[model samples]
Target: MAPGTFSHPNSSSSSFILVGVPTLEAFPICLGILFCSAYVLALVGNSMVLLVIVLDESLRDPLHCFLAMLAAIDVLMVTSIVPKLLGVFWLNSNQIAHTACSVQMFFVHSTTSEESGVLLAMAFDRFVAICHPLRYRMILNRETIARICLAIVVRALLVMVPLTGMVTNLPYCRSLVVPHSYCEHMAVTSLACADPSPSRLYSVSMSSLIVGTDIAFIAVSYGMILRAVLGKESCRRAFSTCGCHICVLMLYYIPGMVSIYMQQFSRGVSVRAQVLLADLYLIVPPMLNPLIYSMRTRRIRKAMLNVLFPRKAHACHGGQ
Candidate 1:
């Protein structure tokens, strides 16, 4: 390989090794078991949410519809990253083909962007419900929600395909061993022989722009909802309604922000800490979102019970 040239255009035949958390290399089995367990839990929990939504006709409304979208994204995000991680941890099968790595990269980023968009849409839904109760259905009907989801998908594809394409096309003439677990854009870009400034800059700018814009919109929505309900008799109830969403938003964004800062800006942060936080930001939320909704939302709780313990649900309903 020359000084400033790539080894190949696409490097489709090349393979990259994923060493799951270099600092935690000694505990591969433990880490593998841990993530495997979490992955199972996430799958089951999110699957149950989907199952209940499908089985219960009442959950077909806009709110549940958004929840369904969120659950699906969670599943996709984890599935894309975790299996490869498990292989690295347990089977010592860390080598990933370039093509497969690119696919995983695409799914990880696209799903994240889609999730952010969905969260913003959910915030808008809450805004309408709380601020314009009488017109909530009129504003967020089935057709409108469908269009919003379509737009989220389209935006993700437009941004992520180019991002992934650019990073994967880089000439990786150096070490192909990715220090982190999955095919994180910057981590893989670091292995390239050429200057990675462009990919790094574009990724950071696009991600910040998308996430920042979503956060700003969510804040404005909540602010309006607060103004609409302040000092009113329904104030407490209104806050309660939005509380679940607030908790979910915090879960999704706070760790994400911490991970990005630790990865890009902070020199004092340890690689182990950086890797752990990065993994958790993607893994923990999907496992917890269904639990949060099930415990907090009465309708979902009822629907879950009805699906999982039908006999008990029937007995309770009969007794009621």
Candidate 2:
């Protein structure tokens, strides 16, 4: 049990308090400002990405479509928790209702899984474009992209519904203070008086099965892409096109993996470190995804520049 206020055994009426970054006790105001800045940046950046893709018909290629979907997911992912996080840090209002926490957990997990699925889909797009250039248009048309997006959403819900249900259904008679920034599945389950083995097992198994499979597919797709591009004049171009995606993948997964390992296996790791990693896992990717894609992808770069400097872009276009 956590060392905080106790809640009733009935899960419906219970509440949890989020104790965000106790190590920042000395600089709560500074931490709040920093977090707020990151949140605003993520929201604005992702919104710009979505707007650019929607406004520019030329940016409707399958790859850019996937990128837009990813940006939308990042926007939702950060919005799901960051507002409450600010409440905790700045307002000192840490209490969150059990139901609200459950909702947060669901959104966090679902959006995260969807992001992984989208990345894998993007990898497939890259693979098709590079290895099967002639068939790319026929293979990844509008209908196919729509189907892929729908399937990703469905998969995320199917995997997360049961797992989140298991955690929320557990009777939490113990302390209800979650020593983290947001209501995570593991953190919430840890507060239950009942043995959380089922929740734990499901968390690990589902994550391994879903996210692991996505990573494996991405790896194979990139492997084949590499094989196809090797020793060819297009090698540099292909690699450059995929570089931004690979960086986003690393940023998204590495911190999450480390946080999970620490939470489940490494008992000696400090709570502060674990909490910090968890915050990073959620915050860093969304804030950087738009920036990375904009800077690295030529099409997105030009589109963004056009949006920012339409007169100049128009002059350049007329000159061309």
Candidate 3:
């Protein structure tokens, strides 16, 4: 419509309430179905990973410990987005409070940090086991694993808390509309009335220092492990386990790189693409993680069969 002319878009906006999403007229039903599928898949798969690891004592090892941490971090990652997503998609509970948004940001950032750190730690564990098998017992004993995990958690919290706090303290009077499905740092930052230079710089600097460092360490550890593994006759078995983990991590990191690139350089990327990419960051890792884990481990596979098919064996034996 012309500047002085009336338009249906404005007329419709005047009659509507902002309790839910701004609008969902086109393909809303299809989008809702996809969202629910991703959420269910992630929730079920990660839960299975946690249940199997926690229930069986024979599953306790440094490798499983890191995998458990990965599963737990993924649980947090998906939960941070899924509830609000269901609300936005189906329920009319779209008005998130200021504090709620900040808490969500903090957890999102912290859990991402933990994910990267745990990946690095897992790489180190495999490195030590493959490259220094004779010294693996001495280097990654139970106490050392606990200490390393503790340090990862602490470092993740330390890196994330302050950055989130800084962003939360800024004024948000310009707009209440968060463009994405959930409360995200970049989406919220775009709403700031004042120049968000400091916050933006803080976010970038922190990501570089924290995430960059974590990936760098993972790279170095894997390089050494590859060198050692290639020299051994057991290289095939070692790569089978290590390769699956690296593939999962790459599945995650590849999308992560795409997101960071699109966020930084591709202003023309559609909002739907942005949301879809973020979904990959959560749903793919959680769903694929358990599949890869159980496939790679004999103990987990045996336990899975025993737990799920116990009555089959009992029936086969009759009363004998």
Checking candidate 2 for backbone clashes, the offending pairs are none
Candidate 3 residue lDDT tens string, 90-192: 7656667666777888887788778888888888988888888889878999999999999989997887777776776665554466776766677777766
- Please report, in order, the local distance difference test score of every candidate based on alpha carbons: 0.89, 0.88, 0.73
The ten-residue window of minimal lDDT in model 2 covers 3-12
Q: In angstroms, how far off is 61's CA in candidate 2?
A: 0.8
Looking at model 1, residue 199 earns an lDDT score of 78
* Ranked candidates, highest TM-score first: 1, 2, 3
RMSD of 2: 3.0
Residue range with the least summed lDDT across 10 consecutive positions in model 1:
2-11
Candidate 1 stretches with Cα past 4 Å from truth are 1-13
Q: Could you tell me the lDDT of residue 314 within candidate 1?
A: 99
The TM-score of candidate 3 is: 0.87
Q: Compared with the true structure, what per-residue lDDT tens digits does model 1 show for residues 1-320?
A: 63323344455347888889977899998998999999998999999999999999999878899999999999999999999899898889999988888899999889989999999999999888888889989999878988999999999999897788688667777678888999888788888987888878888888899999999999999999888889999999988888888999999999987887678778898878888999999999999999999998999999998998999999988999
Give TM-scores for every candidate, taking all chains together and pairing residue i with residue i: 0.95, 0.95, 0.87
